[model samples]
Target: MNDARPPLPAPPRPVRRAAAALALAAVAGSAQATDVFRLEGFGAVSRSMGGVATAQDVGPAGMMTNPATLSLLQAGHTLMGGLDLVTTDIEVQDQATGARVSSGHHGSNRGPYVAPELAYAQRVGAWTFGVGAFAQGGLGTEYGSSSFLSRATGGLDTGLDNSSRLLVLNIPLAASFKVNEALTVGAGIDAMWQGLNLNLLLGADQVGSLIGASRVSGALLPVLGGLPDLRGAHFSLTRNSPLASGINAWGHAERIGMTYQLRPDTRLGAAFTTRSHMADMEGRATLTAVDGVAGQIPLNGNLKIRDFQMPAVLNLGVSHTVSERLQVAADLSRVFWSRVMKDIKVGFVSDGGGDLNILLPQDYKDQNVLAVGAAYQWDARWTWRGGFRIADQALRGSTLFAVIPATPRKHLSAGFGYAVSPAASVDLAWSHAFREHLDNTSLPNTSAPIGVNHAQDNATIAFTWRF
Candidate 1:
């Protein structure tokens, strides 16, 4: 019989979780796990080493990294796939000693990673057309143990040890049109989803504005076998906050970009992705315990809602060919995290219309990212490339992140591609992040708070194809 080798599927996942988790962990700590962590920048195979330079000549994947780059396609078909192994170990703050509470009290996420892309561009006269699909951005984290959440909320004071779970997902589709020899335009739409899980804290408020009586008929505490007097006194505060509800549904983000060729060897590109919005979530939370072991907490207090709008980003990039076989590219981008920081609002649709609100740290600092990379050819089938990124300040001032204190981050990356036959090439890349865990510590009533610090390290790999 003749030898036979069936075709294998694409890479396992295009999203690099190691880099994703590093970026997310660097975004915040245990307390504010939901808001601080963000998953973007997929297809690490390309952006991993450079500041996303391929955006110009990059076709399918370019829709995600740089849609404007679609105009630079040399008239052909292409496919790109990759995997991201992201693992995280996050710690909550210890209120008493101002130390990491417990390593077990952490957030770890994995799976649901697959980024596939396909692009075809043909020059019909002077105009070009292309379409592509990519995972774009999304991530998930399951934190704390079941016992942790129950224990934390059962006590009179639940530090930050309550169990927490979070998940987010995204898929975007993009298309481009070449208007002329030097000008191209493109647009995209992102379908995204998010979810979070949190337990009840014993005393949130005094129910000062509530209409019902403070005391109910039953024992605020519980009954334990053999210990009749063990069931002590417990209090129930008013669930007046409107942000405690659960959110489950779908939303979208918009992307638009333009690319133009300069004087011959030089090219420039720019783009903007609109913000994302998630409405209120619906769920229940109750205080469960036994004699001296539990309290009468309200699980289904009222309605809770939260919205995290990804900041609108601005990107500017320029690429220049130095010689026949040598080319270099650079990119500068901004993430406007300050927009939804403090101004973010959540309302109750079922309630009779009351003002139930809390103050979020609106002092989110601006973020800047700079990248530079170049490609070199040793022969017709071999090419080499590398790049780096210097990120802006991610953490604001004190009170910025009490439960979770994200740190400033920087990355060092490199990659290489090998041509297969005449129409295909495989790409490989690696990136490492060196982060300085800032001081993030707070006391129950410390007039002047203390600082808790930490650090991070991670790596990634990817592949690309051209036909």
Candidate 2:
């Protein structure tokens, strides 16, 4: 018998280091959201009532919507935990090639995406203090390697994966003060972490268009200009590992809010959350230059993502008690997406004196959202809740929009609350976002439009314990 066996191959040193760096970040893998990358609501109570927490007492989740509402917590201590299950149905169609592809969510191998939340609060004298961890918002999608969208080199399948995921998580510490019988004011600071993963392929013409439109004025420009004909070349950023090992960054923001009693049965609330100040997202990426004279060159480099931050938000709301058993609430909010999402700026620096910058335009519009909800007490142990939410789609039809389709425009939700005991309770909620369709009219170098479809179903369950 032959005593010698071939030594098992190992991954390259750079790949090993990249994987180690990503593991050290300790970030969870995949998350999806509604409301153009934001969840329609944070907790079971809030989602059941169409995200109407600005003036309502929804336990420690108030730290995310309106910290002032924390003043409504019962005396002593409270603990809350919740989980959100999200299911998305997405389809992409290349009109020119008459090919269609469905996202991984539609297959039996992939299950619904999950996000978790936890919070604790304490009330002492006229002050309420709270802390919580919440998933702020994100968007993600994945297409299989066999999909038509993964084709390169004149419609030949390259078995390349195409996907993107962006996740934002927030940790907040807040304090609320009861200024009198009728007013409560609160403020908080939030430390946030964001992670992004992308595996994309662009044709030569698309790369050329991006370079032309981008701000590229360095030694790199002359080098790119001198390259051989790029008509058949393609650019790709992909890795052998999974999407979880992409890039991560940390940031912080501030929020202020107030709630006032307009009448014994009516309350008004307003809150403002500042934009996040995040550091550049940095990670290792495999950049491939294929076809043309480049002839399949693989460059290992560090990718830097600049000017990627969440936009500021402003919210105003009113809650009114219609009867001893009935309550209603409404909220209007504005999201300043145009300010932060104008373009995606990325720079790549290779170890061998090669660097380039690319700018992908987003041109997102500010979004206006309206939410309305009502709750009814049923007997002593059960409360019924229902709500509706609506917002316009923010991104215009384009190739990038198809990859990151966060375009749900309307939602219907319903749920119930049950009092398990005097000190413990449970809340359950379900929501559905109707189907939305978009035409990709602005694809680079292609006049034929691509069709994108998206819809969603979300369920949330939360448990609360009060001492």
Candidate 3:
């Protein structure tokens, strides 16, 4: 009976250094939201108008929507800063056993996620230049160690953690040029960052099913499959740090847009944003396995996340001033989610020998969004704004939906703007996503029924300075 084990392999120097940098640079909050992991809007003004910034001037925030709107800025240096506070309510239930778990309940506090935005733009001659940082969007959930999802052998709580988090940030350099009295064109480039963390526990049957569908390599599969009575076996992956994601990556993207003046008081706008090109995310993970024959085995490994990227987006909009104090705007957008979110591939190479690859299917569909808004001038120093948005769900009903529940369908918003002085102003907005419910009867390996419900509330405040 030999019980000795070989020493684990060490990651390359570059991977180690990059992982260290990511750990140090990671932020505390996560961004998850309305448009199936994407926020409905970028700033207070845009949000107040149902994210209809394509044809209207929303100040520096336009860099994220339609850069062509930058040409409508007042001729001076303009700076804007904004913060969004989001609170989400998620509930999960085991339809067969009647066991339930809810986010922000039973000691889990995953609400009040903070996302910030900053932008500065300058208008000189016939050109406008802008630079800004924006928290794009992602999906996250946390079910503590005591939840039914953490149950293992003999239906006993294993105290295993089940959680997932993803965050994306974008920094853009944009410029708009006024070609003529009736048209303006704009272009921009974005430096993107993405982070992912996962802590999952899978039963032996689930693991076997994944192995059957996954792209298997290395010499370890033979030994793992030779074991007898795998009914009590389980596999788990845990992160090394709580503050940072287990894996992170960087990427780049480009966008182009234009605004056309249809009439003296009417405008049309359009924008195209390309998909991101990201590198594979790398980090360290702790892999643990428990089996009826092999007992419990713990191994250290390097984890790699492959082919994770954001989808391309196309936006079209119109804005019209009906009277001196009344304005209206409308926008339509298409998100190509099917192209990038079909499947997520993860590979783990243990230190001792061999590697394992797993493919998680998301089967996300393309999403379409429609938004409409109106604004009214109440007085010389006050303005009122209201908006509504509707979007189709991106995920199909399946077990995957229970793991990542981001399926809100309708949103309503209202806000107001106040002029503090001739050179400064403040905007505030609030939005709510109606509750959505989905039942999961498409479990891959098991016949467990699951139900998920999700809803959200968000508030944004922004300040602008003109000099």
Candidate 4:
């Protein structure tokens, strides 16, 4: 009777809870949300005029879209910066049942992210030199952990958050040479930084199928009871927790551009950007079994991603002054999406344990963007601008999904600028794109056709100073 009950075995509850908390905090500081894959433009000036910066010498922001435009900057140095506030609403539904696939928390992932712009240029003799920073664009979509899709596989408590996030920033140090009055050539090196986080849910069937692929080669079957025969299984598996595997990479690219004065009143411009190859991403991936295997096992380990590169870009534009007070500009750009994203491969980081490999199909087709705008000097201190743009979708009919479902197709924009003073001015613009609806019936793994609708509204403001 004097036996003091052995101190209650250290409760396993605390240890389990601690492990869960650590997993959630993995991608904490680095998580950034965005909505658009490519921002229409870099600064307020570009945003206001329907992203028309290629030929008309907009400012330092032009250095990013078309470095040759740097040759058009005024003799003095210029500084400009702006912030973009964007909002997106997307809804994905099961085509057959008309039931929503997501949790109805539309655009919850949308955030007011900053698109910074900075540049300084000086003209000496026949050369103009400058440096600047800009954000091209990014994509962000988030769904609740207890979404309709999640519930289909297990109970509401199953932690399943499906989302995607990407952010890119570029800095260019460049020089422009006015070889002669009619022609200006420019070139630069770009320091590009990119970060990405992908968290997706996979059905047991899909995971099982991936295991069957020749690539996996029975290497992953031994894990978690040899990959259950999920063909008819009701449970699901989540790829990884956000913290486990996030990508923070750096790379470089080259840019060359030229502007030729077709006539005193007109200018033709072109710019080319080489593809940037980023370092492979390394992090941890935690795959948890739900429903049938609930709490039975945890597949967590280091993950490695192959080098990912953005597509090369080619832009050709023309700017013409119809009158002393009116100017019109147009640009056409080709993005080699097909070359960079034909296939995406993900592998496991073998630190003392075995790993798995998988290839996600993404045969994206190359796309083009067309933009046209007009700027009119309404008065000595006021200017008005308007423009329109159309961009082909990178993701096609079968591959579109609930995560990052909105791929913009067309945009309309308008704005104005006020001359606060000779050396200082402010610009503002607003843009709206109609909702795009996509129907997916051919994609594999879909029990029912998927339908998605996406719409957006964007606004920007920037202050510029000349010194």
Candidate 5:
């Protein structure tokens, strides 16, 4: 009988395996992984792009888009890691009152993130194996009554609060084989651990307070015409907020790449990474709310978002040397975010009656990137580097998540490196993103007009230490 599982297909060829490896490695490498205001071009060059070298010569960020990177590590065992700090300015408005207030809780030193990365590479014969750990992306906004949003909800509403963190720890086991004196091919498998925590708040409203005062039937009623139990207005906030969040994810990635020396002083490289089809995203969303007149609700819900594919990416880079003292590079890349944010069917479960299953909008889009950078060796002991990149906005003018409010942006940046010696180097860089403001959630009343404001901005500084 053909019950032998159809004789498992032959293991992929070494070349095929290599390509699969690089693709797998780029699983979470997308524009969404970048800082709030920074765009990629989506994975285009920014400060992180400078950490790894690609044949595109766009500096180091290219490595993030592919796994063929181990081939460029000088030699021996090298370690790289860095930290990034970003901030954003946000606002919410009342369309009814034309009152726009700054969400005091808008931006903080702790957003887009303090992404920490670690990568180590070792050369074995003609092959290179590397491993790394970093946070791809994770963000959520919280708007309290401090802003017009609070005024709109009643005390009735605490505010809008949602937050999550996704960390992708990658262990790349790869081997690079030299195809020729001028070309090298590499492939690897990336084991990833994706962790996330989500918090949400559904709310409730009281009729007594809504209308203020009224006359019931033939008698005068106290405050707003609302009855004691009239028009049960209850907005059960899906408290995505957790008392103590605890969740994690584990997955695999495959990648492949090729790099060739075009000239004695120049090199070109390309990488393809596989996307991740989520088998299942299971987690829990803790909830809290005020029921009717007065009551604090405590709830815990188990959530397994569902299986969804991450997205695939293509990366091409080039690096050229003008002289012994100057080196220049550029890279072009594409991320199928459109696929990543694909509309999907989602389900939510809680102890009692929580979000059963819902179809949330997959409101993301595809993106492209362009990065250019250079490094100058100032002596045997000193080296300097700098670069710039552009990223695109995923949200358009109308979107449901408008309450969270996001605006597309433009970022400008510059940085340099200081080599304490041949064994130690410190790198520092800065970037800023500016977005216009318009409040879209505020559906207007007679006194207000609905509008969307994404007037947001960002400033970032990153520090890297390499040995």
Candidate 6:
């Protein structure tokens, strides 16, 4: 019945501090969410139904999902806007050292993240026109510059901050034609924008290794040894394009969708979104030289992120009314992730004044998502909804990192809506994914055992006005 903690083995002052610094930095700069950072749902009603909206015309979000559904909206002008509040958690443990650390509590600069959306649709003659702007998805994690990752390494004074953010936005203009009472077709043009900000610092130990192995050779090593070991080096080796000015790229894509009314209470829909061809992300990069090396090293005067593209997606859905006041729907989606993320490359200038590049192999696979949702009219002004969704992981073990944890495989959700007027209404929804646990020991280096547990919560509310 004894409950006590075991003391960790104490390494040298430098080793312990260095180990702690590297661990924190890696965790802080971890990749964004696993679902490839794609948001599950856009509007409150759709989110409440596990993002199953392909055939259901709940709001103006059709421009982002199934543009064909635009023609199905009641003849009028409709505006919809909403925001999502997300909470994420990441925890890591080093196997070689038995050291464990968390990204800090939920609210510790990591909690309550926000995403916004807006859509407007209008009917003119037989055509329905719509425009929408929204963050397709994003993932980010920030750790204080003075936290363990920095304190153990050298603190904020060294100008090494552990943080990363990846965001993608989409603006689409859509039009749908109602060919007949039974069918409608639509298409859209999307202006896609992507941006990234990453900062990773190598502590003294890694710096010393890099200097000894890459910079100095037999004769140079002996001479450099007389100066100083890189044990005191505080090198911000991977700080690239500040988010304000970093890798910002723009691209274009197309989407087509169709909706068919099979019966009085039944509908079927399909949609296809083309992959985007974006320009390479470029930015200036600088590195603090190995301590006592005299000056900073222009390692990457111009860093180029090569061949970054978004995947194409296909969706099939069905909606039906099984009872007088109840409707049910399901959607199946295919995300061609493997086609776009075979590998990630970073090209930079080497200290030797030559062009060099690093290729991080991804070898991702295609993934699928299946969602089923139901809505029940509880009263003249109230409706209740619930949904479930399951997805396949696209990333393989070789590509998984502590910073980029696995995406969740299961999601459970619930939500409700109220009609304030015939032309206006509001909806609210919430979803939760259980924690996903991962253990990685196969990384090339005899690195420590790295374990990460990730989980998330999403809450959304949207308003719709019909004019």
Top-TM-score structure, candidate number: 3
User: Which regions in candidate 2 have their CA more than 4 angstroms from the true location?
Assistant: 1-33, 105-111, 215-245, 292-295, 445-448
What is the C-alpha lDDT profile of model 6 across 110-153, one tens digit per residue? Answer: 34567678989999978999998877776665554544433222
RMSD to truth, every model:
10.5, 15.0, 15.2, 17.7, 13.4, 14.7
- Supply the global lDDT for candidate 2: 0.75
> Mind giving the per-residue lDDT tens digits that candidate 3 earns over 402-433?
55787887787878887777677889988888
Sort the candidates on TM-score, descending order. 3, 2, 4, 6, 5, 1
Task: Give lDDT for model 5.
Answer: 0.46
The local distance difference test score of each candidate is: 0.46, 0.75, 0.75, 0.65, 0.46, 0.67
**Candidate 5 residue lDDT tens string, 1-467:** 00001122333477446534533333222222232322232122235333224564321232455556556655566555555454455555555666665434442322444555555566677776666654444443545334444322343444444323333444555666766778888777767655444333322222222122221111111211233322221122232332122455567767788888999998888887677644565655544434345344444666565654556766788878776555666666666667666443444455765354433344566666556655554444444444544445555433334344445344444445555545555555554444555433311111123454443322223223333
Q: Which ten residues in a row have the lowest lDDT in candidate 6?
A: 1-10
Q: How close is candidate 2 to the true structure, as a TM-score?
A: 0.87
Error of 4 at 449 (Å): 2.7
- lDDT by residue (tens digit), candidate 2, 1-467: 00011233444678556544532231122122246878888888888877878888777898898999999788889899988888888888888788888877422223366778899999999999999998887776777668776665466555666676777889999999999989999999999988877766666566666657664444445555566643322233433332243777899989999999999999999999998999998888866655555555566778888979998989899999886556788888898889898887878887777787777778888998888777765535667677778886787776445567888878888788887776778899988888888878554523235788989898999998888
Q: Give the lDDT of residue 41 in candidate 2.
A: 83
* lDDT for position 272 in model 6: 95
Candidate 2 clashing pairs, residues 3+ apart or interchain: none
Task: Give the count of colliding residue pairs in each prediction.
Answer: 21, 0, 2, 4, 73, 3
Q: What residue runs in model 5 are displaced by over 4 Å at the alpha carbon?
A: 1-53, 56-63, 94-112, 150-155, 158-171, 201-247, 287-299, 344-346, 353-355, 400-409, 436-467
Alpha-carbon deviation at 42 in model 3, angstroms:
0.4
